[model samples]
Target: MSTVFDIEQKQDSAERLLAVADKEPRYILFADEFNKVARKTVESAIHNIELDFSWSKFKNQKQYNVNGIKQVHLLRMQMKESWILDAADEVWLLIDRYKPKRTIGTSGKLKSSGFKHAIYPDPDNPKRPSEILITGKDMILDFGQAFYFKYFSDDAHTAIGYGNKNLYQNRSWVYLRFRLKVRKGDKTYYSNSKGVIEMLVKNDYPIGKTLDYKLV
Candidate 1:
């Protein structure tokens, strides 16, 4: 229900654009030019933004907030190692009940340590799958199935796994097409220091926001 005049007022007061477009369209013209750019993010002041907060009451479901956008995202099982590294905290750890997994970025062969069993390096060199570290139910800290990982160098960012079946019978690998994250208080985080991630959910965070805004 926004008009040309309303768009002009919004641009004048609250819209802090990241870059000036080549074509400086007018209020209505700019609004109409939404699909012209490859990828564009429009900004609005928080005070001027309207949102509805709600959630389902199922045991498996969690609570989350809705921002200017409509679609809500959930915690995906298959994710990249970089995401865990950025979202985890100092004390947090990635939890996998049956077989714990860790992700590292490495150019050469990756090494594992500090566990009871012998380390199992990946078989396929080209398509490296989720490699399990040498650990057991005994290695499970007070935090339970949350397994903590330490990196040798920095480039060892490769590995992530989640699934519970017969260990030596049949193993399945699923392709990851989504991003998972966490929410603490009013913040939604995509990555962390210790790479600890849970099936938690978050919304409208700067990392997930459409347009990155700043004080004008």
Candidate 2:
């Protein structure tokens, strides 16, 4: 039996719970802070109970309101296992279908250091390996605000960014367009947006479905 920590895989599983909610049809949200033991307990409960629904990891704190409440129920466990997994598979598939374009990253090192400041011992030989030092630079690409079918509307969109930075900073924002079509019983029910795009790349949601997301 896999523990909650094993399934959730993060410092706080609460954010993952919310990310799961964002893609769900009911639009409910779940939030909680769990240590390793607590997370394992929840995970065991989820697996043993055999609840139905999808889940995602959360990345930010500003999105969740965890002042007084301890646990949150984001989605009703009603779907069958096959259905849940199928939906997740679809979401993953869609993400694979629309892979984001690679842009330059933003972190770098000095291309050349003066001879007097060289770190290597053999600075006299121009042809020596110490004569030239290899350096690198990175750029930040911002992929701004993504929208989900269940909660996001025309005006509001979830913002996301990518680059080499710590948890607190280094994410850039960019714009994305939806190419796929989602219809329910002859009516167009869902469409991918920028939020979905970022979630797909950053959060690792299943194809064809949405889930709650938070940054920690």
Point to the candidate with the largest TM-score.
1
Residue 44 local lDDT, model 1: 17
Q: Per-residue lDDT tens digits of candidate 1, residues 11-87?
A: 22124342434446564334335423311221111112221111222223322223222222322222222322232
* RMSD, candidate 1, Å: 20.8
TM-score for each model = 0.17, 0.15
Q: Judge candidate 1 at residue 38 and give its lDDT.
A: 12
Full-model lDDT for every candidate: 0.24, 0.26
What tens digits encode model 2's per-residue C-alpha lDDT throughout 1-216?
Answer: 332223443343666666665586456323333344554454333233222222332122222222211222131122222232322212111111122334445544333311122223334423222111111111111111122111122222223222322112212223222222222222222222212222321222232122332321
Count clashes in each candidate, considering only residues at least 3 apart in sequence or on different chains.
Answer: 15, 42
Worst 10 residues of 2 by lDDT: 134-143
Candidate 2 local lDDT, residue 119: 28
Off by over 4 Å in 2: 1-73, 81-100, 106-158, 162-216
Residue 179 error, candidate 2, Å? 20
